[model samples]
Target: MESAIRITRETEFYQGYIRFKMAVTNESPYAVNEVTLDFVYDDELLRVDRYEPLYVEKKGKLHLGSIDGGKSKSIAVYFDPQMCSKGTDIECNVAYKDYKGKRYIVQMEPKEISVICPIFRTVSDINTGRLKEILERLPHSESCVFEVLSSFDMFKLVNLSREVIEKRNVKHVRTLYTKDKTNYELWYYGKTKVNDDNIVIKLSFLAVQHTVELFAATQTAEALTGLLADVGKDLKVTIESRVTGKGRFNLHLINSKITGNTINNLLDQCNMDGTCDVNIVIDNINERTNAGRSSVNNTNFLNEQEEQRLEAEKQALIKIEQEKQESLQKEKAEKELLRKREEERLRKQREELGRIQAAEEPKRKEEEYARLKKEKERQEQLQKEKAEKELLRQREEEWLKKQKEKLEQIKTAEEAKIKQNEAQARLRMEQEMQERLQKEKAKQELLHKREKEKAEKQLKNKNASTCQKINSNNSKSNNKMLMFVVVFGILVLIVFFAIIPAASSSEQKAIDESVKGDNYYNQGNYDSALQAYDNAIELDVDNSTYYHSKGTALCGLGRYDESLDSYNKALDLDENYTAAWTGKGYALNELSRYDEALVAFDKAIEINSMDAQAWSGKSEALFKLGKYEEAQAAAEDALDVRSFG
Candidate 1:
């Protein structure tokens, strides 16, 4: 029921190795079949080699298995310090499980682990057999979890199940999985172990890209190494390893060229569009049965793409069908118009016959008696027929007029539709062009910025190199000038002493003391220099130079308290001594007395406003006191002064 693993012996070796020891006591009635240890370290430099007796799978994974409860086991593994970049620390964790499938941490220990320092000169400078030796002698601890992931890659720790009667016969472990931004998925089975009470398994998956943390809940290195190898065959990189400890001390190195990035990218590629199912199983040694849990889902990228493609195809089909419909409607409208015109012609002929018949019928009736009566009746019949024909003609004419109107409306509608389609197409084209141009402009701007940065870095390096050369030359010139001055002074002193009355002994002694102090200070003998300066000040307390010299020496000796007092004395003697104020500020700042340091720097700035050092000191003091904005302002002020000066 306890959360953390207990440490029997957790220590780091000097040879860049870690050793962990733990007691696997089985408190339950069920026997512990197996124990697994998972070791993790930060191996950035890849200083560990393949042939160093370290067990690493081809995919940069290691697995160690077979630890029993009520039994104590020790694991030792080496880490290559050369593989670690400067400032990176190494750490590890241990996991324990019982045969009855109950899981818990080892009873006694701290979770936090410290990294051991390596022999820097041998690996960084010498570099010969260094990796092998270091790997063999790595110090490890069972107290905490050691996580040794190299880069962000797609990997999964899977617990494989062998179907058995009992549900408790499942392994416990954690696997890493990763997918790239593009969403591609990969699957790999690492390694697994079945022991008396506990089962440890490792599985590698090639989907979901992320930086995963290694925890104690993970299985042994042996299982993980095998799983990585399975995944590595299809991937650009893989991790393989051999297990040591209850999977605690992983003396395993990676045999993988697959960078974390490559794995992640592949995962992204896989997940970009599809359904993926990742299954994990837990097994218990006592029951010989394992239970499995599966997670399956469709990637959002896939669903989105499918939806987009479907929408696009649907729109295209609709557009094509609409065009066909419009064509059919146009042809039908033309046929209706032609039929209307033919009907109109027939109607005109019918109206003419009706007029002729009516006129003839009235004349025939007056001419003949019996013959006239018969002829008149026939004429009346003809007139009736003509009237009927005239009515049909008018109906035909009305139908023709309606058909003409419909034809005109169709023509207008077709033209308007065509115009609207053209306008929309034109707008889409213009928008696309604008977007392309904007993208091009952005790319150009990015290129320009990168070029500017490169040019600036080059210029800075050139200036730094030039300044170093100039400084070297100046030092040589100064030495030559000093030699010449010393020689000339000796000659002048001999002539003056011989020609004039000798100076008083006190004046001579004072001058001698000042000369000695200057010599000692120049030679970096700060204590001696300070003593000599004290003597000089005793002889002439008003001498500001003596106080300044003493303050400079005290500062060099790390006597900031004494140095601040001396600088203040020098300032009292000469209020305009800018150098003394600078020294005092520096000393006070060293003592973390920022307020006083600020005041001293401010005074120096007032005396000589263009002094960059005084302004810089003020900035530093402000920064230390958590006044970042003020610090920035002060720094800017110093830069302005330096730039202008």
Candidate 2:
């Protein structure tokens, strides 16, 4: 059968709880709506306590809203494994509804681990779906019988269960009667034996829990005496080899050889002190010795004859029981037929009476319906008017409230802009004042140099008389003065040509490029802004502001990886730049590196506690990391910062 929806489950174990992850996929061509999953499991074994996500869990039902065709959705449910029933296996069913409100159910196989006896498992640990493989292997070798008696009807028994009906095997099957009521003892025995000497596996249903019993015929038990011990009339053997790993034991007999996985399964079903006796049967232990070979052969031949007689008697009993059930069923069918005929006669009588009454009451019924309809229409009109008035009033109130909030936000933003503009104006005034002072100092130095040149030219024109006289009078003092003047002039020329011009051209041009990038960014031209910022960086590679602006432009282009590089460069230049820190956090979040994003956001907040962008980015990171409450708090902080900071 094709399913309308497909469900898969995975389980995870934690310190004190269990996590069950369930995914529901829609397989149909049309969408499924109102897809709610109602969990059904043994309440004694597990309780659906809470969720790993999808905050709402009510009475074990989860509302998944809607699923589009070919789409899948998943949820994780937490469980507390505490048992009230000792030998119960943990299984679950999910009931869900389709678009038309029709319900369907799906069953999940039991887990390998139990609540109280977690280390142990039975044939029940095998997924019910895989039981067919084990059963199909039984026919060629029905000489070995396997029976699993589980109270769960979920085993899908019709896949192939055959009755042995042999007197020898049926006698060993568990009794059908227990307590006051009858408990089903699902029994099956082997058919034609291919090789009676070899072992075979079997599965038949029986009780609330599952157990597998294996049987085989041995001609001479002496050959396999070392395999088991006979204590009294009961066979008792204890085999315990430690399984190396965790998880369910693999007991499916794909090969004839028994491995550690198979032994581990048997060990799980063993009783306290580690003894497993319920599974094995050896038929002819006493007849294996040669001393009693003739006597045992006579006894076995007679026993076979007697077994034939008993099998005939059991078949007779089954035939008698089938005849009894058929007789009862025939009687029941006659009674049902008679009752249904009587009901049909009564229904015809009622219909005849109804027709007669309807023919006589048409006018009165029509008048009453017309009057009722008029009254209903009047009431509906009044309701419509009242509803319209209420809706209008609500809309007016909501509109006024929204307008007030919008105006407040606008006012705050305008105030912030005004303060920024005022700061820029003060900065411009300072720059102009410094430029004027530099110009005044340069003008005085130029005038001093020209006057020195004029004085030297006039002295040269004195026909070398004054020059020779001064040189003759004070040659040593004159040389010292001349040397000092020449040195001072060279120093002034170097300052004018080297330091001031470099500051005015290279560094100033870089600042101009950075400002242009900011303008382009404000205009939402991210490509142009990025180009301008790159030009600025080429001119002044050490400036933090250029890198910060470049990061913003890269973010605008949705290039988060490169944006992260830019933000990191900015941070390396100025570790205390709050905007760079915030931008780095935002880029990290876009890259889905949430933990590192939180650190960046925290650092930004530490530098400037009122950074709304930092708070908002922190909120998003926390939400992605599954810290819902912390995310909510950070979101509220961001809102408050934006509204009033």
Candidate 3:
């Protein structure tokens, strides 16, 4: 039956498995049904593991169901590299039925499958003669070999070997060390299952050298070789032993008689140690002896043959001499007759040539003269065109010169205009700066006047309050006349006679200076307030109020440490000074001495429990100390006291 299907097969090697993909297209007019594909490969070299659509073990077949006309179907088969022997081919057979239930089977030509062991790929990459020799010596049918560079360490080589094996799906890898511990062995299965065939790889390290040797009993030598080569490339080292047969001589039998002794001598010359099969053509001893006798007799028979050969040569020379004499007589007769005929023909041709030349001479001269006249007119026209071109060139040069001059003048004008604009801009900027400065100066003067008036008003209020307190004290003294009249009369006589004038003079002046400092402090003039407070303290050094006022001015100036010292002095004069204690806490807080600040705040609270500022300062110190709970309580206390006030 005629075939109506086209099939294409492809094979690829990935890790240890060979993948076969077949694309089948139906070219018939009717749809094909029950399409099944069968893959046949050498069982010893390859074993089918799985396939697409449907996979049947042992049979290596896949059922593709059906395919429509002009449609295609693909099937893939994955198989393990069993032996990986060279020169092996894999066959594919496709069987299917058409819509009429007519069965047809197509057997495609066997495709040559190359199971390139990774090791062989690596050997190819190195392309070294030494490596190729080593690869040829390796048993390609059942074994593989690998050698690490002289610079590689054995420990790293072993680790890299395991990685290479694992990547190829080899499992249960275990290392074994030799008795001397100088050599190691790795045993693993070709597949993930333990029951599968195992590959035994022996590794040995060369002493006093940097090279490592690896030997394995497996069919996937190519895979191992490629892995080692890749590692060598990554390490920038060279692999010394890669087995290849590229340059080696491969013996083949030809149609020639070779004796056993000759074969032995040839083998000896090659120094071959391996077993080799030599095909020999057996012959009978009697037949060989008769042929030798026949060769000797034929030599004598050749002498007789030479005499007959000389006799034939003599006869041929005699015949050639007779023919030469006859040819010379015929040639002389023919030459005499041809010479007479040639002379007659030449005489007639010469007379005809003279007549033709005499007639054409005048016509030739007339054509020559006309040609010369046209040449003179052409030269004259060219001279006229050259003169006009020269005149046009001169005019163009003059026009360009005028254009250049105008462009230069315009450029100069633009540059001058830019300079004038820049000068005007600079002058306007200077005027604006002057105006801003004048406005700032006026604002400062107005601020100074307002501050002075505010300070004066505060000072007047302070003086009035002081006068009221003094009057209150005098009224109290008057009210206590009945109860301490005798004591008061005695004290009044002592103050009037011994202390009244001196106390009034020095203490009154100190109070006035203290008031002046208070005014300055209220006006936000801490530097002047500090100086005025210093004067008051000089006049009355024992006055705790004077020191307290000075500490306030110091705190306003951000001199927390100096402020603390002044507050301390105030406390020394009067330990119960609440304002001084609170100011000292604020100064300590500013100095980042949170613990000392808390203690000062506690003291102020003890002296005057209603002091809200002291409570707030204590809360701030607590917050700084990371005591969130205590800080919250203190803050609440501050709010309560503030609300009460």
Candidate 4:
């Protein structure tokens, strides 16, 4: 089947998790259905922790419902990197059904993944032959090759190589291979294999001073080459033959043909006790053997050649030792000469320094004496100037004193004049205040008398009206009794027809005015509502409902004090009026009288437990009093009552 889906994926290691992002696109002309993705990886290397769609597990499968043609969907998978080894591979497979309901599967290529670990590049640029020679003499059984150079310390070289190996991920073990005061050896294992061979490079000191060796054992030349290639050119080595003084020795076995056994034999020959130098002469005696020579003569010639080689080696050793002694003597003489020259140079420098100091001493002392004499003259001049300044200062002080006394006199006269003027003003103000107080008292008395007379007159008129009403009612009752005796049915009809409708009409008119006031109050027109409520109260002075409504309107006008008075009046008319009590509480809360407000609210609540306004007013009072917990409880109660209603 032609590919219907195109998938691209990328992997990243972040915050200890290996996160994979995959972009899956439906490339076919038809929509894909039942789309799903499956991931697979080495369990030893990677562990799947989580995936998008939330429920994906190590089974590595994700179910994508569907994808429309030309549309794309993104999938993400996360795994723990710590669970995986380095250089593991992760694989992904995508399976989906096409529009025809035919199943199709796509296998994604496996991606190679690796974790970062410590690494150290190998070093080269070293003399391989001499290095091999030293490694052969070391107390080691493993087959190894080496490079030796004369300029580096063997111990330092070994330490540096160990440091590099320890930095890598390979498990390394170091052991004492050999122990000597001058010559030392160390063995290390758990070396990383190069070219499929377990090999380890090592360094150690040689018997010859200032000479070190670098060596490694490998099963194949290819392995050695691979190791050497990684070693690169960083480890610089310079080789010089002690006997020949020739350089450029290739350490490769194939090129040099000098095996480890050969090097060991050479070291044995050099190490013979009391022997200065011993050279082993290896010749191809077969090529030298001739048909004319006898076996005995050939043996004699070989022995002679060996004797000659031994003599030459002895002479070379003597020459070397003699030259070494001469060089040491020459160095000693040069050092003594240099020391004497340094002492002579220092002595001259010291004498010159003393001469310069001695010449400058008198000149310095004379300059010091001149400086002191000039300073003494300057001090005397400064003293004379100070004396002149003191006399001028005394004169200025006297003039200032005279000016201060004259100014004080002038100030005293001005202060006395100000006092006189202030006293006159005070006397005039007191007289005016007394006269005004008397006028105000008279005016208040007159107004009080007039008000009292007016109130008495109104009371008298009210009493007269009440008496007339009582008389009229009594006369009517007497007439009804008389008429009833004469015409009982007609009298009863007249009493009901005349008196009941008139009283109902008056009460209805008052109710209508109160209704109007309630409408104005509801519309937020406090002024109009107040006027309407006043008319209603005037029509029926004893109506507690009108008084309460008036208080509500006054509160709406922000006239809390006036509203309080109205509420008090309503309470007077009907002591159990809950609305008036709640209104009074609200007014007191607005006026910041929180303690009194709470009392009023409590009274209202006592009257009607289910009253939302009473509860709400109580909450406000409690909040003003800084009783937050009680306020919140009261607020909740108010909300409960309102919700129920």
Best by lDDT: 4
lDDT of all predictions: 0.47, 0.54, 0.56, 0.58
lDDT of 1 by residue, 1-645 (tens): 343233454444321222333333444444443345444343432233222233334334333344433444444444333221223323333444455343432323333333321111111111113312221232221111112343332211221111110112232221112323322221211112232111112223322332221111112332222222222221111122211233321112233232211222222222222222353221122122224534333332335565476456445544654685577467546644764584466456545654664576466445446676888999999999999999999997886555445333432443234334433543564466457656755765675576557556655755665566555777768656755765575576457544432333444455557668767876879889889989988877887867877887898899999898898899899989887887788789889999999999999989988776777778778877878678767767765775675
Best by TM-score: 2
Score every model by TM-score. 0.23, 0.33, 0.29, 0.25
Kindly list the per-residue Cα lDDT of model 4 for residues 216-240, writing each as its tens digit.
Answer: 4444442333333233111222122
lDDT of 1: 0.47
lDDT of 3 by residue, 1-645 (tens): 478899998877543356778899999878999888766555644666566756344444677878999999887777655333444667766888878555666877778875543322110111123222333443422222233322444544444444444434443322334334444444333421322322333333433444344344333434533333233222221112111243221111111111211111111221123222242111111122354464322221125655466356335533643574466446534644564475356445544654564576466556666877787778877887887888798886775454334333332332233224323543464456447546655765575576557556655755665576555666657545633654565466555435534654576567667667766765779999899889988988998878887887898899998998999999999999887898899789889999999999999999989876777778778877878668667767766776786
- Show the lowest summed lDDT stretch of 10 residues, model 2: 231-240
TM-score of 2: 0.33
